[model samples]
Target: MTETKEWFESWFDSPYHGMLYQRRDEHEASAFIDKLFAWLQPAAASSVLDIACGDGRHAAYMKNYVHEVIGIDLSEQRIQKAQKLAKENLAFYKQDMRNVFRLNYFDYAFNFFTSFGYFQHYRDNVIAADSFAKSLKPGGRLMIDYMNVDRVKDQLVAEEVVEVEGICFNIHRKSENGKIIKTIQFKDASGKPYSFEEVVSEFRLPDFKELFERCGLQLITTFGDYELNPFNVEVSPRLIMIFEKH
Candidate 1:
C-alpha cells in the first residue's frame, strides 16, 4: 500500500513518530512551561488553549496554573492519548490549527515545541495565524515556540542515523524553497520499511510579524530559548515569541 496523504497527515499519526520524538515528554514540557509562567505571571483565573498539544503533556501541566485548559491537535492517535489525561478543567480534542476551536474565548493561547510552519502553503500558515488570533480575547496573549531559522540553517546536520528501541532511523535534511525539509527512513521489527518527510517553513521574525499582524496579533517580546534569554539571530537555538491580541 502506497501512502498518499500530505506528509503531516500521515507522518504525525504514525506510531513511529511518537517513538522518534519521545524525549519531548512531560518533564521537558513542564520545565519550559514553568519558565514561561514565571515570566508571564498569568492570572490564576485565566483560561488557556494549547494548540498542537501533542499528547496533552503541556496542557495537562498548564491546568495546575490556569483556571482551565483546552488542548487540541490534528493527530487522532495523539489526541486519543491526550484525552486520557483530561480532567474537570482539562480537555483534549482532535482539531486543526487552521480552524478556530473557540472564538474570543481564551486568555492565553500557546503553540509550543516548534509546532508552527508545518503547512507547505504560505496561505495555510496565514490561516493558522488568523485562527490563533481569533481564539484569544481582545487583551489575550499568544506564545509561539519555534526553531530559529538562522540557527537551524547554519547547524543543520545533512545526514544522521539514530536507533531507538532497536529501530534504526536514517535521517537526511536540506533547505529548499524557503523551507527546511527532513526525510526519515526506518524499518520495523518485522522488516517492513517506512519513510517520512517533515517540512517546516523558514519563518523568520519578520515573516511572523507580517503574518500575525495581518490577523491582529502584535508581537510583544521575543526570546531565543527555553530559558527566556534575549533572541540572538546568530546564536539562539529556539525562537520564542509572545504576541498580544488587538
Candidate 2:
C-alpha cells in the first residue's frame, strides 16, 4: 500500500501530531513502564522490541530492564528523532508494522497507547498481527495497550477546542463504520489552514482475540489501566492485553 493512502502515514509524520500529543511524552511513558516492569519482572537479559515506538520514549525507559532494546515506527521523522538515543544495546529503525521485522528475534514485544487499529482494512490488521507474531520468538510475550471500546464510546466528547502554541485545534469526533473517527482542524500562525483525521477501529476483546489467535498469539491476561487494574467493560478506560506466542 502507498503511504499516502493511510491517514496515520501523513499525520504521524507531521509536526502537529507531536505538538498535539506532546503531553504524552516520556513522563507518562516512564510511569507506565515503571509499573509494567514491577508487575511483569521481565528478565534482565531479554531482548525487547517496541513497536510503533514514537520517539522511543517507552523503549528508552525499558532499556533499563532489558538486555537489548529496539524501537521501530513507520514515521521517518520520528525514527530520525529517536535515532539520536541509539547506542549499545539500544537502537531505532523505521519500519511499517504490516511488515515483519527481525523474525523470531525479540523475547518481548510491545504496542503501547492505542497504536494498533489504524489500518482501514481488516486484512491489513491481520497482516500487522501476523507481523508481530513473526517478529517474536516462539515463547515471546507481547503487550498491547488499547482503549476500552465501550468506555470510549460512552464517554466520548463530541467536540472540543484545544489551543497549543497559538494554534486553536477544533476537533470533532464520532463513531461510524465500526470505527472512531476524529477530525482536527487548525490554522497556523500565518493563517494557513490544516486538517487531519484519525480513524481507528473500535475493536473489542473478541475482535482482538480472533485477530491475534489467527497469527499464533494467545491471550494471557488483560488489564484495565496503567496501574494494572482488572478490566471492566463499562468502566475501564484502557484495554491492555498481554499475549504469548505459540
Candidate 3:
C-alpha cells in the first residue's frame, strides 16, 4: 500500500488497527459517558454529535441518554461497521471533522478517546474547532477527551511487542517536533507484512484555550481523567475538556 502523509486514512481503516484496540474497556467508557450525561443534563429534544466516532461505540451508547445521536468519522470502514448498529435514534456518517456537518444542528458534541490532534498542520486543528463551533446551537456544549501530553511524555514507552490472534505486532513510540508518533509493524499468518504510523499533536490546555477563543467557543472546564477529576498538567493521564459555544 502506498501510504500518504495523512496516515490516519490508511491506518484507521485497517482491520489490524481495530484488532489491536479491541480490548478497550467498554465499562469504563460507559461510566464516563454516564457521568458526562449527568453533568450536561441534556434535554430529551436535544441532539448529540460524536466526532471521530470510530465504529460509533460511544455514540451508540449515548443514544440511551439523548433523543438523537449522530456519529461522524473519516474512515469509511469504521462508518460501514457503525452503520450496522444505527437505529432510529442513532446515525453514523462518513465525514471529516474539519468540515462542517451541520450548522446549529446539535446541542451537545463529543470528541472522545483522544480523537483530536491528528492533523499535521496547526491550522487544521483550528479549522476543526471552528467546525465544531459552527455545528452546535448557541450555548451548545462540547466534550473532548484527549491524552495529557505532559504525562505521555513523562511516561513514554519507546518500544513494545505483542502477539494478537497469532499475529506479531512490534510497536515503537516517540515524541518529536511537538507531536507523538507511533509506528506499528506486524505480519499475518501467511507472512504478509504491514506497517503503519499514528501521529498526534502535543497540544496543551493553553493551546486549546486559544483555539476555542478564536473559534467562538468558551472553555468551561478541564478534567484529568475518565473520573472527571480536576486537570493537573504534571500527573493527569488525560485532559478532558468541556466547552460551550459563545
Candidate 4:
C-alpha cells in the first residue's frame, strides 16, 4: 500500500520500531529518574506528568518516587500496552502534546529521551511547549531531555545499516535547511518492505528559551546529560533543561 500519513504516526506504531530500539537502557533511564528525584525533591504526594511516555517505562518507575503519575503518548498502540501497568498511582492516556492536558493539574512534568522536536513547523513545537507549561501549577517544573543539536550535527553519521533480530534496517541521516532528517528503510520477516522518515528541528537553547518565555516558563537550569553535569554546547551528548512555572 502507498503511504501518505505523517512519518511519526506510522513509524512509532510499528512493532519494528520497538525492536529497533530494544536496546534502550532501562537501568540508565531509571538512574536518571532517580537523580532527578533526588534533585527536585517534590512533595511525597506530588502529581507527575510524563509526556510522550513510550511504553510507560519511565512513568512506571516514577510511581516509586511521586504520589501519582499520568503517562501520555501519541501512539495508541504504545498506550494500550502501557495501560496494563496502570495502578492507583499510575495512569496512561493517548494524547497529542499540542493539546492542553488537565490544565494546572500537575506538580512536575517530564519530556524525556529526545522525544520532542518531531514536528515540521516551529509553531507546533511552541504549541507543545505551551501545553506542557499550562499543564503545570505555579512553581511546578518541566524537565526536557533532548539531544545536543550542535554535538549531533558535529558527529552526524550519513548512513548505516543495522540488523536486529534478523531484520535489516537501512538508515540515512542528514542536516538540511536547519533540520536534522533521518530516513529508515526495512523489511518485515515476510519480505514486505517499508520506509519511514523522522524530522527534528535544529532547536538550540536560545530557541527553547524563547518558547519557554512566551509560555510563562522560566528557565531554571541546563544539564549536559542525564547525570546533570553542566551543559557544554560543543561536547554534551544530551541537552537536559529544567523550566519552572512562575
Could you tell me the TM-score of candidate 2?
Answer: 0.97
lDDT of 4 by residue, 108-169 (tens): 99999988988877888889999999999999999999999999999999999999999999
Which regions of candidate 4 fall more than 4 Å away from where they truly are? 1-4
- lDDT assessment of candidate 2: 0.92
The CA lDDT of each predicted structure is 0.93, 0.92, 0.93, 0.93
Worst 10 residues of 4 by lDDT: 2-11
TM-score of each: 0.97, 0.97, 0.97, 0.97
Question: What C-alpha lDDT does candidate 1 achieve relative to the native structure?
Answer: 0.93
Pull out the clashing pairs in model 2.
Answer: none
- Give the TM-score (vs. native) of candidate 3: 0.97
Residue 239 error, candidate 2, Å: 0.1
| Residue-by-residue lDDT tens digits, candidate 1, 1-246 | 994566899998999998998865566667889999999999999999999998888899999998999999999999999999998989999999999999999999999988999886789899999999999999899999999999999999999999999999999999999999999999899999999999999999999999999999999999998889999999999999999998
* Candidate 3 all-Cα RMSD: 1.7
- Model 3 alpha-carbon drift over 4 Å, by segment: 1-5
All candidates: CA RMSD in angstroms?
Answer: 1.9, 1.4, 1.7, 1.9
